[model samples]
Target: MMRYIGSKAATLPAIQSIIETHASGATSLCDPFAGICTVARHFKRLGMRVETGDLLWGSYMFQLATIALNEMPTFDRLTPTLELEASNESCAAILSAAQKVLAWLERSPGRPGFVTAGFSDAEGSGRRFFTQENAARIDAVRVQIAKWRDDGLIDMLEEAYLLACLLDAADRVANTAGTYMAHLKSWSRKALKPLQLRAIPIVNNHAQNCCSRTDARETAKTNVDVLYLDPPYNTRDYSFYYHLPETLVLWDGATPTGKSGVPATRRHQISDFCVRRRASSALDELLGQSSAKFVVIHYAADGLIRHDEILDMLNGRGKAQFADLKVRSYNSRVREADIKAHHRIYWCDSH
Candidate 1:
């Protein structure tokens, strides 16, 4: 999976334990702000019908590829190009297929396009997001994938899987401290390595899982068993900080005008949760509309919504309980050693 700001990969076990303890009989789980589908994936792995949605196009792509998807890609047209044998375990076969596809991509010539022009370390681009060679390789792979999809050579699931691989590959070699706000002045060893696509782990449990891109407030009206919320923690807007990965998901062909290589207008990426003034009100609206029996919210120690306020809102609706967990933060604004942060898990059963 790709690196994300609020990813719950490490602490998913603890949260899942809470959910299992509180909502054991829950049949369905809904994650409206399902960036990269981490929480939804946790529930899906447990054989629950999961509903996931996110405002970010990149996250949407990730959801489609990882959680919402029900089957491993066979790549019929690109056969043996992505070799697979049914006798092998399903996951092993998928990994083999990904290996072959990446091998093919590594042989492709570097082509020029939006990625190469905008993010490459080429002189005068003012962006050092990727090495020039790796940037060109990304453009080549992206262009090839798009061509394949446009020509109907691949189905939606296959396209999504391929794109997901590309996104992860790009993120792997990006010259930053796990963010795109500003590239490091010097390339890290990982950034200097050649870009390589690897198999992205996806869940294919036999559950009726679905994904959507919609407003969280509206989605909260959906009746579900477990409603997991992990909204923006601090002031960092993901749209601005992680815009480069999104460009591949969105495929918008526009050059950035700012020195930081971020677009001038970010209307498409604005979120009330990212604003201090609107955080509480947004939380209120979302909580009021939640139709779930159990609601689990993950918030940072320094988040805009105060501890008392969140507990009050949850308690008003049902039995609210919380636990604190010390997790390492991924704040790019600070030095690597200073990125430590803590999280609070507020679990509620509004019966």
Candidate 2:
């Protein structure tokens, strides 16, 4: 099953192999920072109970949808209704809203101006690329979806999946760079561009699973056989990188406040991921509270977290051994480039 959470999902087979080698009868697996629930879903497929936690709302939704599959309402029955009414309403509302925003942008000055912007010259009088009209339509659909969710017509998981789909679709039509922070240098001279949204089947065959939205450091006391730690490598807060989509889905129409209140610029910011003094304390707290028999932490060589420091912290708590693996080359949307030779996958075991 495709999971919306977890990085280094490509490395899961190796991680699973190690788990099989060390703990054959492990009844449960937990991922503290389960992004897309990739690891949790893999274990769930093998009949092991899975528990996941993430502070981010979107990540929490992904974990709940992926791991808590048993609780989901049957998609077969719901799909037709969703497709005809909810999905259409949502898409239409998004489009309407986006068009409204685009019109506002045309009248606005500075970078927000559209009539005088370079994008005005795209094929088909800019509709071939992206028109203020399309943007409003996208926003209109999203607004409708939000309203439906608020009215209890859709559950959280369903709403989440729908929002994810909309986000993916909007990304295709967005006249911005790969991320929403930057405008596209050239607009697409096309209409009804390709939409790429991952759809979750209404009928999920995966085993029963559950997820919680809480701090990992606090949730480690549950009884489990394996505790998997994949904390943020440096301080790259996912909130900022994916804020555009989040803002759209989670938008209350309230003005943003402080630093996070404003939209980010094209230039990437790296301040959050930098090593901080509190990092050690947080790690120690998590290690101390985990009720699992063994702990496996995934770390990267280029992160603010030092391998020696992590090893020392784990060793101080219980019996520990460290294993390392090289990460395959991968492109990062936030980093906007391919990371060369990023050494990753640290397996720290506590027996």
Candidate 3:
């Protein structure tokens, strides 16, 4: 998975403990703000039918590859059109088909195209997001995948899986310190490596899971046993931060602007939760629309929406409880090493 800002990967055990204690029998889980689909993947591994939606195309790719897909795509439709090598004896037939496809893509020759023109520093784009060689490779693989989808050589699930693999590979080689708001002034050691596409891990929970690219305002209405909320707590727009990965998802030939090379389409990626004035109201509206037996919210103590305001909103729904876990602050300006900060988890049993 990509290095997301607010991924619950580290806090999975704590979250699972809470869910087990409060919503032990939950058969379905809904995550409207499915950034990287980390939380949804956690529950999906536990055999719950996870429903996830996100505004980011990059996030939706991960959701589609890791959440919605319950089995390794056999690429049966592709076999007739393309010549794929047989899988090794150690690899299962179920997983081998996808492996062969990845191998074929890895051998794709690097071609300088849209990605090279806009994102590679060596190509005179002045953006240090990727090396010219790697950017060209990314361009080649991305365009090939899109062509396959356009020509009906690959299905939606297969296309999503391939795109997700490319996105992760690109992130590994991205010249940034986590977010792509701006690339590093100098190239990082990892950015110099050749781009390689590896088969991503596939999860099979034996449940029918679904994922969509949509606004949380509409997805909040999904009925489920457990509803998890982890909306943005600050004003950093993800579309601006991870726009490069999204370009791989959209494949739109939108011209890049400014020194950052962010897509012009990024202007439409605003979220109400990022604005201090609309943050609380947006969350309130989501809560009002949610129909879940158990609602779990993850928030930072130093968030724009105050602690009391969240408690007030949660309490109004039903019996609400909260637990605080101490963690280091995310602020780079804080010089003090001993300062204590925590993320608060509020759970409600909406009877």
TM-score of each: 0.91, 0.70, 0.93
**Candidate 1, 199-290: lDDT as tens digits:** 77767678867777777887677878999998886778878777887778767775576756776654555788988999999999999988
Candidate 2: tens digits of C-alpha lDDT, residues 1-351: 321223567778878887888777788888877765777767777778888887656666566556675543433323334423223556546443223322332332232122212222323233222455555445555665666666666677666766655555555666543433334445554324533344433324354555787778765777788988877766655666555555665554533333223333323233222346566677777878986877777777766677778878877757566566765443334432344445555454556
lDDT of 2 at 286: 83
Which regions of candidate 1 deviate over 4 angstroms? 78-99, 333-338
Collision count for each candidate, in order: 0, 35, 0
1 versus 3: better lDDT goes to: 3
lDDT of each: 0.81, 0.57, 0.86
Candidate 3 backbone overlaps, count = 0
Q: Rate residue 29 of model 2 by lDDT.
A: 85
What is the descending lDDT order? 3, 1, 2
**Candidate 3 lDDT tens digits, 1-351:** 677777777788989999999887889999999988899998898889899999999999999999989888888888667656544544535547788888788787999999888888765789988999999999999989988898898998899999999998899998877777778788889999999888888789988887889888788788799889999999988898888888789888888988888877545668999999999999999999988999999989888899999999989988889999875444323432365567999999887
Q: How accurate is candidate 3 locally (lDDT)?
A: 0.86
- Comparison by TM-score, 1 against 3, better one: 3
- Model 1 alpha-carbon miss at residue 186, Å: 0.8
